[model samples]
Target: MGASGPAVLIAGPTASGKTALAVGLAAALGGEVINADSMQVYRELSILTARPTAAEMGGVPHHLFGHVAAGELYTVARWLADAEAALADVRARGRRPILVGGTGLYFSALVRGFSTVPAVPDAVRARWRERGAEIGPAGLHAILAERDPAMAARLRPTDPQRLLRALEVLEATGRSLADWQQETTRPLLGAGAWSGIVLTPDRTALRARIARRFAAMAAAGGLEEAARLDALGLDPVLPSMRAIGVPEMIAAARGDRSADDAVAAAITATRQYAKRQETWFRNQFSDWFRVDPLAGEGAALATALGHFGAGAGGAAG
Candidate 1:
């Protein structure tokens, strides 16, 4: 551990047992868990986002999970600030902080820092949102490809929220989103202050877990949650609305698709999202310790404990 001590960062694809491992580590090290997942911040997205339940937390304190409303825009900057505060609070109490989730960008921003993009004018933002609503994500992505090819090449066409953001930034500042990202500020955690791990569970096993998890979600009131969110009549392009299972489950709730079909679609979408997450982790976290949770949770836990020089009955550092 450096002068700042060691905080554990656990990142992995969805359904990779990150939550369980985080809880286990927190319980062992007298630490608290801070959420890094983008969707899990929404209060209405518990089931679909696979947020840990109270029982799953095992009496270890968890922060920033389900703290924001679904209709609110929760940006990476906001999450970074919240996480920093949570980390400080944990350290102030002489407890380790364990940040865990599948959101690679969150981890990236925390470790590598992020530039604060100038806020777009309200009119400019509304205009881009209106265009997004009219053209849809694919059409918006096409427009981005024309205006900012470099940024477009980096973003997925199916992601409307990011597309709208990129278009708004370009129109508002006359610069590409990629250019803004390159002007990074100081990171929250300096080098050697934190130990990071990326879980790389076997794809076959992860896919099966995703399918089973979605099935469990559907049985555990996921449809009701989706219907409730849909009833709010929020913008479809909102981040919460774009969560993995929301669209399919909303369609099922509205009778546009059968429940079974919706579940299948949601499961497929989740698997695709997991693949993207895995790719991002592989590319961006190449230097971090890698653990395959599919092998055994004990081995993964042991590796993490080794990093902090902590035992099951001791605190990290």
Candidate 2:
């Protein structure tokens, strides 16, 4: 953004300690933190999403965190607009902006730009979820393959939500999802705009951490929270509504699974998400600096902090 702009960013899958790393880097670099996350924006879902706590924030200001109400679905375009404003403020105050989050799409939008992926109306989401129940996730995949075979070719066969969105976009706009995607041209960072890195912790360690975090969540009242949300009867397809553990916990609350079984399922789902995150950063951002969390992360991040003045390369997360 400026000659002296804060160039540091920390990103990784959930429970990889990206928040802790960001807070530490901000303290080290005289910077502030800006969220590049999706669910972390919603105030109501903070605890479930593992949002940075006041204690975790440690007096360093956090932007775009817990500012949105649960009901309002904020899109990536809105996130970019909001982040630009935050970056301006941070730079004005002579503070570096450290973007951190688990949402790869948000970070991708911050770097590679995104199109107006229409916010699927609640009715639209409901219809798809209902169809999914009747015909299964594979059914949604087939529907999308028929409408936008190109996009389908790139996605998992059972990614019901994405398949549904592609079909919805084609039906509603008379254009394929790939066409809108092709229109995406904004390099999110605006050409040499900011220095960034993805923290990819080891898979063995990441899976262990995910299991431990879910175990801790269970002990700390995840079940209770799930019970509370279950009473609301929100559609299962809403982004936050379908957070990693929600479905498992819901089934447990409904007596379809034991608490132990639910925890296992949630842990399994989180591990799956982490694997996707790993593959995403590895393939999509092969050029971006990476700091693996298991190794010399502190020094590696400090090196990344100098990216604005002097670019740094990979360091194990």
**For each candidate, what is the lDDT?**
0.89, 0.76
Model 1 ranges with Cα > 4 A deviation? 1-4, 310-317
- Residue 148, candidate 1: Cα error in Å is 1.7
Q: Estimate candidate 2's alpha-carbon lDDT, on a 0 to 1 scale.
A: 0.76
Candidate 1: tens digits of C-alpha lDDT, residues 1-317? 32234788899999999988899888887788999999999999999999999999989999999999999999999999999899888888888888999999898998889889999999998998998888899999999999999999989998898999999999999999999999997989877577788899999999999999999999999999999999999989899999998999999999999999999999999999999999999999888877788787488777767766642211112
Candidate 1 Cα deviation (angstroms), residue 64: 0.3
Q: List the residue pairs that clash in candidate 1.
A: none
Worst 10 residues of 2 by lDDT: 308-317
The TM-scores of all predictions, comma-separated, are: 0.94, 0.87
RMSD of each candidate relative to the true structure: 2.9, 3.2
lDDT tens digits by residue: candidate 2, 122-181: 676567668877887787788777767888897787666667677777766778888888
Give the Å shift of residue 303 in candidate 2. 5.1
Per-residue error for 288 in candidate 1, Å, reads: 0.6
